[model samples]
Target: MRQITAILVGAGARGRFVYGEYAKKYPKELKIVAVAEPNEERRQLAAKDHGLSSNQLYESWEQVLDGAVMADVAVISTQDRMHCAPTIKALELGYDVLLEKPMSPLSEEVNTMANASRKYNRLLTVCHVLRYTPFWSKIKEIIVSGGIGQIVSIQLSENVGYYHMAHSFVRGNWNKAEETSPMILQKSCHDMDILSWLIDQRCTKVSSYGSLLHFRPENAPVGSTLRCTGGCVVERECPYSAVRIYEEDDPCNEWNRFITNKLTPEGIREAIEHGPFGRCVYRCDNNVVDHQVVNMEFESGSTASFTMSGFSHDISRTVQIMGTLGEIRGYMEKSEIVLFPFGGEAIEVPVTVEEGGHGGGDEGLMREFLKQVRNENSNDDQGLTSAEASLQSHLMAFAAERSRLEGGKSVTIAEMMELQFTQVKGVASPNKVT
Candidate 1:
């Protein structure tokens, strides 16, 4: 197999750890030829890891794109707001793109990106990694096979672990909705995509309710300081203490390394004392909801309810699907799927949970993306997640957010798309498609 060369746009955690690491493990299958990262340390680290020469290293994405096109694919793992321009430019430059999700925070931008992909005839796959996992894939197969008959309803919950919520939302980069995006788009877009994919129908309407409930100053323990390193009174008991989570003497595991590059005790202590990760969860500038519930009505008249909470003990997705003939219940963490047939014996399907991030979804998606780019696996059975197909989920999320803010008024997907089209009519080119 000819190796597929790639240029990385962002050398952040997702760029380097999730997507770019595939090049390291499968050197014969893929290669990272160039990298564009503003951070000097990260650029050097990525260059050294990918064995790229100095000429291949760029200080910014604009610099990489300013020169000639260098690779077959561009792994665009930039921040949410930064996805649109680079993605469209890469497609125009004759490079297939693997974009990190929530594709863009704005629906119009996502639509524009999708249109560019169609116009350029370039592959644009979003990193909806959950769809590539064996656990969810099996469920999809069972549903499609009529194991549960026609889908009637789905109840899904994404339980964001408390520590993770603190690390990413409270004290990390995605803390503010105004800056990054809403909690739904930033974190739960994966769930929304999964829900839409499983139902196999467009989301017609959505209603939601949520808030930034407990992670506020009023709920903080008395005598708690602004930062965990500020000698808080409840540092020992607080689960979200920055010092306890990041400054511990834990081994540098794959997950920990991705969060904070500084793994040593002293390094972690210094980061906490100076970085955003050290701020008290209750005292951060976060405005996104800590918990949310969305009710979706698909075009097929099937209903689904999704709940995202930041206070779970474990980070996992639990789903229950009801059909005309039976029902399916699954716990993503346990990798167990149970089928209950009407007046029949229950069937319990054992799912082999792969060992890696997102239940091995990161590697699964990377492999599928490489195959797609190489034209090795063109069949639909490969479950390739295209940018166009993933757009509905993002639209659904945008509508859900609107509904949530509008006092749970039911928001139709068509209305959201139409609004986006009108809003971007002057800005977006004439390649719009329904």
Candidate 2:
């Protein structure tokens, strides 16, 4: 296999650990020759792991672009606000781009990137990794094979685990919608994308309702302090206790490993003492909803209801599809799928879970990106999570947020797209996601 060169835009969690590890594991398939990260620690870590020289490291994405086009593709995993700029530049520089999810928090930027990819005739693959997972892939296969008949309704629930909500949404990088994207866009766009893809139709209308119900100042225990370690009498009693979650210094702890690179006791304590993750979950600056429900109607007359809640014990997604002749139910965490055909015996389908993040979706995504860049066979079983498909999902998310803010008023996809275009072209457009 001919190795392809890649440039890393961000060396943070998803960048350094997930995609960067792919290069480390399969050096012949991908060689990360350069990296651009503002964070010193992450930059250093990525440098050492990728065996990149100091000159190959840059402080910012702009700095990376200032240098010669160094890679065949640019793996842009920067945060939501930082996605569009680097990705647009990378495409302009004749590099295939693998962008992180939610493309951009702003709808205009999302449209701009989509148009830019087409304008340049470059492959712009969004990180809609779920499309690449065996679990979802199997579901897609069943639906396509007529095993489930015509998809009429889909019920998908993203049970964002209690620990995860408190750690990432409530305290970590994505606490506030203003700083990041809305909870639906940042946390649940995968659902929107999958719903559209599985049904293979445009979302015509969407209405949603949600709020920051449980995590707030008034919701905090009567005696809770601003920080978790601030001598709150109920520290041990709180399920979201920073003490309980970060007390251990074990590096192997799944949650611990993601929070800090330094897994020592002193490191953990230092983080808890001053870091954002150490803040009281109920007293933090988080403004995103703790629970939400979205209703979608597709052009094919199929419907989907998505519920995302932070109260669940496990971080997983469960989906049930109702069809004319059969129904399909899947649990991503279990990697299990059951087909219940009307008047027929239910069958369990086997799934092969590859080793990596997001239930092996990360590896699946990287493999597809590498294949596309290598000009490998195009006629295959791979689903195209291309720029247009990604844009459709993003519109769904943006419309859902709009409907939520408008008191659950149904928004049309046409209006949403028009609104998106108006803003993009200095005029108003209208549509909603259903």
Alpha-carbon runs more than 4 Å astray in model 2: 249-253, 376-383, 428-434
- The C-alpha RMSD in Å for every predicted model, in order, reads 3.2, 2.5
List the candidate 1 regions with Cα displacement exceeding 4 Å. 249-259, 376-383, 427-434
Cα lDDT for residue 304, model 2? 97
The worst-scoring run of ten residues by lDDT in candidate 1 lies at 249-258
TM-score of each model, paired residue for residue: 0.95, 0.95
lDDT of 1 by residue, 153-267 (tens): 9999999988888878877788887777889989999999999889999899999999999888889899899888797989988887776676664331223454456677677
lDDT of 1 at 420: 84
